[model samples]
Each structure stands twice: as C-alpha cells, then as structure tokens.
Target chain A: MKAYRLRRGAGRTALYIAVIAVSLMYLLPLFWMVRSSLMSAGEIFLIPPVWIPNPPRWSNYTKALTTIPFGRYFLNTMKIVVFNLLGTVLSSSICAFSFARLRWRGREFFFALLMSGMMLPGAVTLIPTFLGWRAVVPPNSYLPLIVPAWFGGGAFNIFLLRQFMRGIPLSLDEAALVDGASYPRIYAQIILPLSKTPLIVVSLFQFLGVWNDFLGPLIYVNRERFFTLALGLQMFIGYYTAQWELLMAAATIVLVPPVILFLLGQKFFTRGIAISGLKG
Target chain B: MRKEEAYGYLMAAPAILGFFIFTLGPLLASLWLSFTDYSVTNVYKFVGLANYKRLFSGADPFFYKSLGVTLYYVALSVPITIVSSFLMALLLKQKFKGRGLVRVIVTMPSIVPAVAVATIFLWLLNPDIGLFNEILRALHLPTSQFIYSETTVVPTLAMMNIWTMGSTMLIFLAGLENIPEQYYEAADVDGGGPIYKLFHITIPMMSPTIFFNLIMGLINGFQTFTQAYIMTEGGPNNASLFYSVYLYREAFTNQRMAVACALAWVLFVIVLLLTLVVFRTSGWVYYEGDRQ
Candidate 1:
C-alpha cells in the first residue's frame, strides 16, 4: 500500500511539472509582446536577442500613443462600442422576450427563420449593405455603423438569450401575468434582471467585436478622425512600417483592454462560448 | 390569459424589420446585382451571366488564385484547430493546481485584437530580426521567411489559427464535462487502457462539439480577411490574396461593384453547398440519447 501510494504521488508530480512546462510555452509569445514593447528599437533587432530589454524604455508607450491620433481613435472606438452595447442589449432582449415570454402566433416559425440567419455569412450581404448605407448616409458619418445595432443585434445573440430565457422557469412569468404585469413590465422587471449572465456574455462579445472590427470602418469611415483603434493601428503600420518598437507599444495599448476584459469576465466568456457551441 | 399575438409581433418588430432590411433585402439585391453590370460611377446595365462567366473563364486573373488560396487555408486550419484545441482541453480537463490560471494564460492570446496580432506577427516573422528566426539561429536550425514566401504564407497563417483556438478549447472543455464518469469507470472495470477509454468514451461523446467546431472553423475560415489584408496584402505575388480581399479590391478599389457582387454570390453558393454536405455526412456525430 505504501509503495502504491508512492507511485501515485510520483505520477501526480510528473503531471504537474508537465503542465507547468506547457503553460510557459503557450505564454511565450505574449510575454515577448510585453518585453518587446519595452525595448529600444535597436535592442528589438539585436542579433543575439537578449531576453530582457536593457534599461527598459518607458518613453516608447508615450511616443507610440502620441505619434498619431491614438487618443481620438480610442475615443471613437469607445463611442461606437458604447452605442452598440446599448442598442444590442435593449433590442435583442426585447426580441428574446417576444420569443420566450410572450404568447404569439407563428413564434416558432419566426424563430426558425431567425436561426437560419446564423448560417448566412456576412460576406454575402457585405456588398449590398455597403451600397444600402452609402445611398442614405453621408460619406463621413457613423450612422451606418451605429444604427444597425438598433435592429435585433444579431440572430445568434437573440437565440442565445431566448435559449437562456426559456430555461428560466415559465412559472415565474405566469406568476407575474397573474399579478396583471404588462408584457413590457415583465420584460423589464423579470426577464431582463433574471437573464444577466447571457446579457453580460452577449455584451462582452459585442464589446470585443465592435472594438476589434476592421472591415466595417475600412469600407465606411475613410476620414482619419473617424477611425476605430483597429483601423488606426493599421494606418499607423502603413506609414511607420519599420518603427518596430513603437508598433509593439501601440499594439500592446490596443491589446490591454480586451485581455483585462477577458480576465475579469473569464467565466462569462467561457460560459457564452460553451453554451453557443454545445447547444449549437 | 390574454392573447398577445399583436404584442408579440410588435415587440419583435425591430428584429423582423432588420431581417428584411439587413439580411433578406441585401441578399436579394446582391443576387440581382450579380446578373447586372453595376459600377458605382456609371449607370447600371443588365449583363446576364457575364460576371459569372468572367469568374470561371480564367479571364479574371485573381478569381481562381483567390479560390485556391482560400481552400488551401481552410484545409490546413480546420483539422489543426480541432486536434490542437481538443488536446489542450483534455490536458486542462485533468484536475490540477491552478488549472484556471493556466487555462486563462493559454487563452489570453485569443482576445488580442486581430490587427495587433497581425502587427506583432509581422515583426516576429520578419526575415532578418524576428524572434522566431533568432530562436532558430540559437538552435542551429535553418530558418525561412514565413509569411514573406508565397508557398509558405497560407501555411504560416494557418499555423496562427492555433493561437486563437481558445474559445474552441473552452467549448471542448464544456463538452468533456458532459461526458459522465460512469462510462469511464465501466471501461476501467473491464481493464481497458487510457487509449481504449479515450477512443470509446471521450471522443464519441465529444463528437457533436467536434462537429460544431469543424463547421464554425470552416465558415469563419472562408471569411478570413484581416490577417491577409494587414500582413500580406495578398502579396508576394498575390499568393495570399484571399477571396474576400480580392472581392474588396474589385468592389472598393476598382469600383467594379457588379463583379464583386458576383463574387459574393459565388461565396454564398459555395458555403450553402458545403453546409449541406457537412450536415448530410454528419452521421458519425453521436447525440447523448444515441444507443451504442
């Protein structure tokens, strides 16, 4: 028994060591990102490549941030992201409530139709949608970008929330209906508050999606001041192609928020992906 | 109970309206435009099947090259992603200290903005001074230009797919959790080895999630644009010119709107056909209720 216990302990130790080794290998590139950000431009391309940056240049971050309209781009991204969050949450929840909570004719049919939208790649509609927006909106406006969020968010989001809302015990809504609660009231009071997890998940996904979106702004927003961080970063690269140190610094600045968001909302992000994947 | 069919439509009106405006309307418009010679600067004229003819006739230099590049990329990425993420999930599935922290670290790369990822990789794969080449030099191994070479560009981008397989790994982890321990114990009772249990228990049960990831990976693979646009610009001889990149160049750069619309329809048809094939052949996927 003592020898058997010793063998099991040995197995556990080996497993832990193996895991640690794999984990470091996985994080090497990201660690390199941060390390590269701090290095002087010459040090970045050092032939021997020292692991640590000598006399870490803190000015790189400032220089990177100030080199162009980084602040303006950051603000533009935040503005777009904020409106998207509001519109997606408000509209999608309402749509989900209609499917999950309200009694209706052709409910399942509409849902089936909506779910089919999931399979339709955005690429199919990219051309016509661009044409559609360009006809009405001014060349430099953000209307085309922001206004679409008012409509249904996206089919997958509605489906995710509807799925979650369905699992929230129809009895609660029945109880509320008995109390003469209006459909709007029930949606606002009961479903919205109860469906926080999926909402956060959807919002987090939306935040990241809009934050990192490149193609949309690339096609629409040609003005430098209207550019999102992703577009701005691309523009920065286009001109300063060889400014490796500053580029790394700029990349780090853009990367930090999403990394922090993922860490803080790790559980929600995992749950969201899992729910969508498994039930998909 | 009060009947609320009117209210149901009323509340869901925004989404319904959006479906018409955003999805169905554009889909039909794009279809029509495919059959027309619609350029932004000129008045439109009907040109039946000419755009489609141009695509397959080898008249357009970019059409076949883009299609081949996209297929090559999808073929490389999908299997590698499924296998690697599954293995990562299995390793993380084991009970260990600080597993959560380790999983987070492993996945941290996925959340980085794609542009930033492209920027970093641009330098990291730089022929002379990149970290990868430096490491290769240290190990006394031969190094080649990764994304700079036409033959290597797609494969290199496909390898980068591994970096963003975090969400896929999480999905696999969730699917792994759903597999009951009883089957594993039953297999153990019969003196089955780890490999036997893996083949019999874990994989069969996880087949549905694997199938889901496979479809999603392929679908997203078809839409891959940012990396090529940012890194290669479909260059080193248009070797990496993705279909979307080609489409964008035609539509936005050249203002050949009708040709671009035709490209979009071709992509839509291809995806529809591929989805049909994948679904029809998904008999290997085992649901929880399926009998052995």
Candidate 2:
C-alpha cells in the first residue's frame, strides 16, 4: 500500500510538470504578442529577441489607436454586437421554447430542418445572399450584418437553446398553465428565468461571434466610416505592414474585449463550447 | 391544444421565414445563378451550365488548385488537430494545480480574431528577426521560410491551426469526463496496463466525441479563408489560395458572379457529400445505451 501511494504521488508530480510545460507552450504566442506590443519597432526586430521590453512603451497603444479611427470601429462593433445579442437571445429563446415546451404539429420536422441547417456551408450561399442584399440595401451598410440576427438568431443558437430548454421540467410550464397563465407569460416568466444559465451562454457566444466576426463585416461594410474593429485592423495592417509594434498593439486592443468577456464568463464560455460538441 | 399549436407557429414564424429568405432562398437563387453569366454590373444571361463546364473542363486551373489547397489543408489540419487536441485533453484531464488556468490559457487562442492571429504569426515567422527562426538557429536546426514559401505554406498554416486546438481539446476533455470511471477501475483489476487501458477502454468510449470533432473539423477546414486572406492572399504562386478565398476573389475582385456562384454550389455539394459519407461510415461510433 505504501509503495502504491508513492507511485501514485510520483505519477501526479509527473502530470503536473507535463501540464505546466504544455500550458507554457500554449501561452507562448500570446505572451510574445503582448511583449511585442510594448516594444519599439526597432526593439521588435532585434537579432537576439528581447523577451521583455526594458521600458514597455505604453505610447504604442496611443500610436496604434491614432493610426486608425479605432474609436469609430469600436463603437460600430458595439452597436452590431448589442443588436446581435438582443436579436439572437430573443429569437433563439422563443424558437427554442416553442420546440421544447409547446405541443404542435410539424414541430419535429422544423427541429430536424434546424439541425440540417448546420450542414449547409455558409460559403455556399454567400454569392446570392450578397446579390440579394445588394439589390435591397446599398453596399457598405450594417444592415446585412445586424439584420440576420433578428430573423431567428441562427440555427446553432436555436439548437443550443432548445437542448437546454429540453432539460427544464415540463411541470413548471404546466404549473403556470394551471394558473391560467398564457404561453408567452409562462415563457417570459418561468422559462426565461429558469433558463438563465443557457441564455447567458448563448448571449456570450453571440457576443464573441459578432465581436470577432471578420468575414461578415469584411464582405458587407466597405466604407471606412462603418468599419468594425476587425476590418479596421485589417486595413491598418494593410497600410502599415512594417509597423510591427503598432500592429501588435492594435491586435492586442482588438483582442482585449473578447478576452475580458471570456475571463468574466469563462464558465459559460467553456460550457457552451463543450455542450456544442456533445450535442453535435 | 389549439392554442398551444397557435403559439408554436407564432413563435416559430420568424425563424422559418428567416430560413426561407436567408438560407433557402439564397440557396435556390445561387443554384439558378450558377448556370448564368451574371456580374454585379446587372448583366445576366442563362448560360446553361457553362460555369460548371468551365470548372470540370480544366479551363480554370485555379479552381482545381484552390480545391487541392483546401483538401491539403483539411487532410493535414484535421488529423493534426484531432491528435494534438486529444493529447492535450488527456493531459488536461489529470488533476493538477492551476488546471483551470491552464485550460483557459489553452482555450484563449480560439477566440482571437483570425486577422490578429494572422498578423502575429506573420511577424513570428518572419525570416530575419522572427522568434521561430531565432529558436531554430539556437537549436542548430535549419530555418524555414514558413508561410512565405510555397512548399511550406500549407504545413505552416496547419501548424497555426494546431496552435488553436483548444476548442477541440475542450470537446475531448468533455468526452473524457463522460466516460465512467468504473471502466478504468475494472481494467485496473484485470491488470490492464496504461496503454492497454487507453486502447481498449478510453478509445472506444471516446469514439463518438472523436467522430463529432472529425465532422466539425472537416467543415471548418474546408472553409479556411481569413488567415490566407490576411497573411498571404494566395501569394507566392497561389500556394495558399483556399477555395473560399478564390471564390471571394472571383466574386468580388474579378466580379465574376456566375463563376463564384458555381463555385459556391460545388463547395456546397462537396461538403454535403463528405458529411453524408461520414455519417454513413460512422458505424464505429459507440454511444451509451446504443447496441451495435
């Protein structure tokens, strides 16, 4: 028994060492990004790479921010993200609640349709969708990026909320129904309140999706005035290819909001991703 | 029942309409447009499969080249991601100090914008003063041009992909958790060694999650665009011209709407067929309470 305990202890020590090593390897690039963001352009390309800037140039952030109308981009992204969050949460929850709680014909068929939607590659519909949108709204508008969210959030978001809703006890809704509460009232009160965790998860996912979305905004918003953070950063890099320090600084700034959101809601973020894997 | 049905339809109307407009409508429109000579200049005429004929007849080698690049990316990245993520998940599944912190660090990369990732990697892989080459030189190893070299471009992109294996790792970690501990305990009693337990028990139980990752990874792999768009732009003789990137260029850059639509349909069919093939061959996937 003593020998077994000793072996188990050694095994744990080895595991810890291994984990620490791998974690450092995983974090190396992010660390370098932060470090590089603080260094001067000349310091960045020094032959013997500087692991840390001696006097971390805080001015790089200012320089980077000034290089582009990053303030405008931030606000633009915020506007889109806020609208996306509202649309995705509201629409997805309603759709999911119907699928999860209500009794109706064709419910299963619709749910199956929702599931199959995941299989359709977004690129497949890119061209005609662009044409369709172009025919309606002029190019360089936020409508294309923001309006889709209101339609039904998205198929994945609906699916996720539906799965979460299925785990809720049907008795809650029935109990509310017994009290003469309407379906919407039950959904607004009982389902919404009880489904807070998954709701937050969906919101966080939407937040990250919209915040980090490049291709959508890239394709839609062409005018410099309407650029989001992703597009702004891309354009900035295009012009300032050699400005490594400012580029890293800009990249870091673009990276911060999502990171903060992740840090604040790490549980929901990780759980949401894991749950997606299980269900998919 | 009538009221409930009404409520269901009312709640579902927006999604159904949205699907019809955004998904189904465009899908059908693209199918129609694929056979026409449409450009954004509003000049369109039915060409009766000319675009597709161009694709198949080798008239556009770039289409085939982009397809090849995508295939290469999918083949390399998916397997690498699966294996590495599983290994990382195995490591992470162990009870360790600061495990949560480690998991967060690993998972953070997936959330970073692809453009930012591309920018950072561009500097890191720079030939002269980059960190990677510096390390290589210190280790007395040969330096690589990485994404800059056509020969090394795909593998380099695959390496970048492997760097962000956190999502896959998390999935695998979740899968590992779902595996009941009793199975391992039983194997232990039977004197099954670590390798024996791994191959015989862990693998079978985790097959479903593995299959899930396989499909998601393949789909994502086929759609790789942002990094190539940002970092290389399919440069150095179009080594990194992904299918989606090529299609984007054709649609927006070249303004060849019909060809791009045709490309979209081809991509759609390929992805659909591949997904179906995986589903058909997924007999090896083992689920709890499922008897094969």
Please state the error at residue A195 of candidate 2 in Å: 0.9
lDDT of each: 0.89, 0.89
lDDT of 1 at A74: 91
- Candidate 1, which segments miss by more than 4 Å at Cα? A1-10, B1-3
lDDT of 1 at A277: 86
| Fnat of candidate 1 | 0.76
**Global local distance difference test of model 2:** 0.89
Q: Which residue pairs in candidate 2 collide?
A: none
lDDT of 1 at A256: 88
Q: Write the per-residue lDDT of candidate 1 for residues A1-280, one digit (tens) a residue.
A: 9997999899899889879987887787777878988998788877788789889999999998888778999999898899988999999999999998787888888888888888887888999999999999899677778888889988889988998998988888789989999878888999899999999999999998888888989999998888889998998899888888888888988988888999999999989988888565
Q: Model 1, residue B1: displacement in angstroms?
A: 12
Flag regions of model 2 displaced more than 4 Å.
Answer: A1-10
Cα miss at B45, model 1 (Å)? 1.1
* Candidate 2, A1-280: lDDT as tens digits: 9999999989988897888888788788888888999998788878788899979999999999987989989999999999888989999899899988898999999888877777788988888888888889988878888888988899889988888899989988888889999999998998999889999999988998899889999889889999999999999888888888898899999999998988899899889888899775
